[model samples]
Target: MSDEVHTEAHGQVAEPQEKLDPEVRARREAALKLVRKYGDPVLRSRALEIDRFDDALVDEVRRMGRLMHDAYGIGLAATQVGVMHRVLVYRTELEGSVAALVNPVLEWSSKDKESSEEGCLSLPGVSVEVERPVHVRVRALDERGQPILVEASGLEARVIQHEMDHLDGVLILDKTSRDQRKQAMRALREALEPRPAAA
Candidate 1:
């Protein structure tokens, strides 16, 4: 018997995750390839906030959305794609569409916390348990450069927090206990190592 408790979202009855668009798949492949694995120097620096808000910024953000989707990631930060802008993108069909938040500010969060399993596109096959606020309020600029506030709970809140952490150069490995971190890092390191071809 499974030891873990399973819910609708976490079980076989769960809704099928949305599929990535073809153009987005091609875009992600042609450009903005996800920097999978940890320890890349670019993933260690803080991201710059979006200030100019021009057509170029819009194009970058758009690419990010396609990248995130085609990479099969529910959320992605600009830093993960080798960009230093404090931009993030995420989506769920239930939420309507892919959304980008520039220079997001975590205005507030509930004191209540929950530990959940999370995986990252950048981490590639690595997952870790993370404790996070169950609810959060974030303020950010939309793709059109319009100001907006986001109130999220449950999985949505968790996804927002995870992506936002990337702006500060944080990763899922940093969110676990020491032992778990050690184990995960070892596994990640093994995955990063090139495998020998069959004889």
Candidate 2:
């Protein structure tokens, strides 16, 4: 899944409804609709390794990049879009360009850890504090199936680990403290609850 909450750290905030450009808002809404929400079985299933790196795989990566941009997310996994392929797209920064990783393997992670608040696109409105490695090394294939290695630290590392977890059917709630998990569950329940019909 992707995290859009960090956008605020870059001096960006959700615009008021009236101030939002209609086309932009529409695109964002449409992109979000493609993402599988929390409780969808696909989000809990491990993604399958992708062996074929064809034009279709390239197209999928492009589509995921567009969706991630439109949804204001830094990263997105195939599972979040109901695709069980072990693929993910991400940008190191909120305003940066996107990159794709296929069949990624976590080669190493530093022992140092740091806790940060993270939000997920699938679990909208829910934020949990998660502790993760401060540095990591990952090996994967590019969208075109070329070998690529990534060494990341801090927020970038966290984002990669978060997306990797999605590939393994794990969520931030599973990595967070019990109290935070309970709070997140409560928030999720409230969001899923149907509101009364408008008069």
Candidate 3:
């Protein structure tokens, strides 16, 4: 759920903000403003199960969807936005419609696993290669509180697992190789470091 397209060609490097269209850049900036960054305490805190399904919940889902789209992310978790509710919004396909899942549970997962590169909006500019199940069945409630079963494979399954990790305060860094974790930590530190004032 990084703020950049998830593709082999793009890999770890994100497109320079200056290279983006003005409007698109502005939207991304605005969306990132609402997302909790790597060092944010909220990003490490596990979310609580959502108990209420009201107008406010619906509104929050809508906001998350818009933010995900604007940030060029495939998925987003409530914790990523400083919300403690166990909710997530995602769209596996770049041009697909977004779906909201509340209190999602990983009902089943295939023994087959695959390793792929993953990025996070919270840890922008950092990508980690992690292994995950190739197929999964999730039981969750829709935004409206209705029970829903999602059987997904491939990219969809990966996206669901990624978002689920966010709910538990587990990050890609935690599941990557030691060297990659060290590299990601360095990048995070540099991102948090203060820059010299313009001369």
Candidate 4:
């Protein structure tokens, strides 16, 4: 199963992704948010499927979107925000905005795959190569609880697969080779280290 994980993703490649909508981005900036970094116990946990689609669920999705934008991340997962629920928000390139999905299930993936660089909000600065299906079909519920089926390829395909992996406690480090994982670990360690206070 791990062998199927891909390296290339939809957005924020080796650089930070800029917010598309200024008004929306301004509102998002006003929202205080936090993203769970590497070594956080929450990031290691498998998210629970969201069964109840109520106001609380809606709030959660909105909050996730705020955090994703705040972190300049194209994609974010429930686990990344310290919520162990199978939910995620990603900025759609076509729509130029974020979309929230709950309990996403990958129904199909193409045999042809590609490899590319991916960075996670949870992992901070480390970007590793990932190989993923160029095309995929997923079934999920919108934040408002409407059923939706997404057929995506290229970047969108990569975004869905990447966020879905997080729901299962899978990180880019887990999907990479041993050497890449080592580099990721070392970077994480450095990020965790205490820095000298400025005078």
Candidate 5:
């Protein structure tokens, strides 16, 4: 294992990912819309297998990264954005570097599991305690469509498992304890309730 870093940049690396072809970009932007809870059903269905790594898919992945940043989110799955492709954008720190994983699969995980508070963008104003592996190894494709392997631990592992679950039609709620899930749902309902118009 080398500590040296790879100095490389993808077309969609920076903030503004070349807003080419205004009309086409706009349409793709719309297609990249975040799938809000109770509004999008694909979020609960298994994502379709990704067979092609074309420009369209790359663009969508980039736009999804942008959307995640725009919404102040650290991770997002393809199904959450109405794309049934095996894709996910994730970042470890808030407002930090973002990475995209295509057709990701967890190849291994440690037996030790730790519990932590987890939340999802789709389920706003709700957090649940969930237990997940302390470490994981995943095989996926990089932004450049190159195969890559990642070994993550602690929070990184947690985020990876969370996003990977989305690809398999699983949510944090499903992993939470029965009691915690119930409480989270109640709190979510309260948070989403509309308040009376201002006097």
Candidate 6:
């Protein structure tokens, strides 16, 4: 595959830094290509293994991290941007603390479950109530490719699991009850419809 980065919106890299350095600009421009949807075949397919954290891969990870932040999304997966790699970026807080996970694995989950509203960029405006573990522990590579284990409970844990599911080609719709899926789909359709021009 080509090493080119994909982007949705044109121009400027989505860097958290104030100045758009060359690297940052490149990453920002590349990320636009990643803002695709669940219907895309890539989203449904399995992700690729992350062997080593090299330059290009590192750049992509950073770009993805910044893009997720720029998009105001709490979490994002590599598949969300057309890469079939098991990588994800997320922020649990708006104050800029972030988490970048590569080849993440959910090591353990709580028996307890909770219902929460979940949505995805690929799924667009469709949001659904889904049941998920209240606590989860995951092992993943940090941005530098170092192994890191994270144990989270409550909302933070829920967000991690939700994004991790995207890595495995699982959407909330797939887990939701059929009736709920149908309702969410209807709402999505309505939201997507083009509005009539003003009279």
Which stretches in model 5 have alpha-carbon errors above 4 Å? 1-33, 194-199
What order do candidates take by TM-score, descending? 3, 2, 4, 1, 5, 6
Q: List model 5 lDDT by residue over 112-147, tens digit each.
A: 998867777777556667788899999999756899
Q: What are the models' TM-scores?
A: 0.82, 0.92, 0.92, 0.83, 0.79, 0.78
In order, the Cα lDDT scores of the candidates are 0.71, 0.84, 0.84, 0.73, 0.71, 0.70
Query: Clashing residue pairs in candidate 1, if any?
Result: none
List the candidate 6 regions with Cα displacement exceeding 4 Å: 1-34, 192-199
Candidate 1 residue-wise lDDT, 95-130, digit = tens: 237888998999999999988777666664466678
Locate the minimum summed-lDDT window of 10 residues in model 4: 1-10
Per residue, candidate 3 scores C-alpha lDDT tens digits across 1-199 of 3333565621232455688899998898899788898878888889999898999999999999999888878889999999999999998655679999999999999999988888888886687888999999999999889999999998788888988999999888898899999999998888767889999
- The TM-score, computed over Cα atoms with residue i paired to residue i, of candidate 6 is 0.78
Q: Write the per-residue lDDT of candidate 6 for residues 1-199, one digit (tens) a residue.
A: 0011112221112234356567755664455446876457887787887887789888988878777765546677888888888888876654457678888899999999987666666665576667888889999997678999999986678668877887888877887889989987887677656789999
Whose lDDT is higher: candidate 1's or candidate 2's? 2
As for model 2, its CA RMSD to the true structure in angstroms is 2.3
Using lDDT as the yardstick, the better of models 3 and 5 is: 3
lDDT, candidate 4, 1-199, per-residue tens: 1111123343333233363367655654343236777888887789998778899989988877766655456788888778888998886542258888788999999999988777776775576788999999999999888999999888778888888998888888877789988997898788768889999
Better of 4 and 6 by TM-score: 4
Off by over 4 Å in 2: 7-19
- Supply every candidate's count of residue pairs whose N, Cα or C atoms clash at under 3 angstroms: 0, 0, 0, 7, 0, 9
